[model samples]
Target: MKLLKQIILLFSVGIFIWACGSSPINNKNIEKEEPVVIANDSLEYEITIIDIGFNLFLNTIAQPEGYYSQEYLETRNRIFVTNWNIRARNPSQFNDNIYENVIDYQPNIDYGYDVNYKLFNYFMFAQRKYKMTLGAGYSRRIR
Candidate 1:
């Protein structure tokens, strides 16, 4: 009985060590590719951009309207800056080329005032910082 317990203990330890020794598999040879835009009209392009931007904002910010204080917003903005820095510095860490896609295919359309404020601001920041041409002349007046 003692021998069986000892054997089980050793097997458990060996399994644990083997698991710890394994590393995540990364396929370095697989090249990252940009999404192909097939929209025929500027409206379709604009809508796609808005959709992507809004989704990104929802995933990263995730704050409800009027729920956060000014200080919290500032802190969150700082966190965004940090995350952007990491992405800019380490492109390999990301699998998608959404950044480049946004720069290349962002539409020039006049959006409604309340349609996509958060995404607009995000793209505006990207335009200013990264010199991306994100429909600068095409956006409607923000009321």
Candidate 2:
């Protein structure tokens, strides 16, 4: 649990640094401060490790020396503009950016006379001003 907390903090800080690195063009003529920009998105990454215990063996009894791991990662993103602090007379003074999404995944498998199981996952997400999306899907595989 402690490790998970630290990892979450580190990931959050890294994202903050990355977001602050870029600055859009500012309107010097505006006598007041401009509003902050915000974006939106959804993301998830998880790994569930199932125990192999000492359930004997499916087909062999050489004491499984191998293992299997599975992982999943998904994300969705959208764009928006809000809190436009305007000092200039022209509405054109607004400056905004678009939103997008990126996803990643990794899985590993190891085999031996006896078998085991483990899992590994790495993923995070951040969004400020956007919408939430949920949908339904059917499961099928065609080759």
Candidate 3:
């Protein structure tokens, strides 16, 4: 009985030592795998120039009726400047392109005034949402 117990103890210790010395099969496979990295050969980065003068001209005409007010018009024409970053990835064998970028919208102005005693309230909000910026001209984009 004592001999059998000693043999069982030795077998368990051997198994523990073997397990501690050997690397796990999952870890070994992961180490052997080659990392997938895309080369920059097919990537194209471009900065687009836009003719942003149309909005300025449109500003000259946008106003409520009655007396012509420059100050009021300027306040109404609160132009919001925004930056856009676009990223696209496609393989060399693919013909289609993907589009992604940040978008901006004009700020909405809802201010009503009472002629008597100069009572007023300004409710500012966004007029539009997510205007995709395709630089230059009044060009239409289809993707």
Error in Å for residue 109 of model 3 = 38
Q: How well is each residue in 1-143 modelled by candidate 3, as lDDT tens digits?
A: 99999999999999999888857886776455533221222332222212222223223432333353534433423321222212222333322232232222233422222210011001011111123332322124311
lDDT of the structure predicted as candidate 3? 0.31
- State the weakest 10-residue window (summed lDDT) of model 2: 118-127
Model 2 scores a TM of: 0.17
TM-score, every prediction = 0.30, 0.17, 0.24
Weakest 10 consecutive residues of candidate 3 by summed lDDT: 116-125
lDDT winner between candidates 1 and 3: 1
* Clashing residue pairs found in predicted model 1: none
Best by lDDT: 1
lDDT for model 2: 0.25
Residue 55 of model 3 has an lDDT of 29
Model 1: per-residue lDDT, tens digit, 68-124?
454444443444444444555556764345343422222233332222344345644
**Which lDDT values do the candidates have, in the order given?**
0.44, 0.25, 0.31
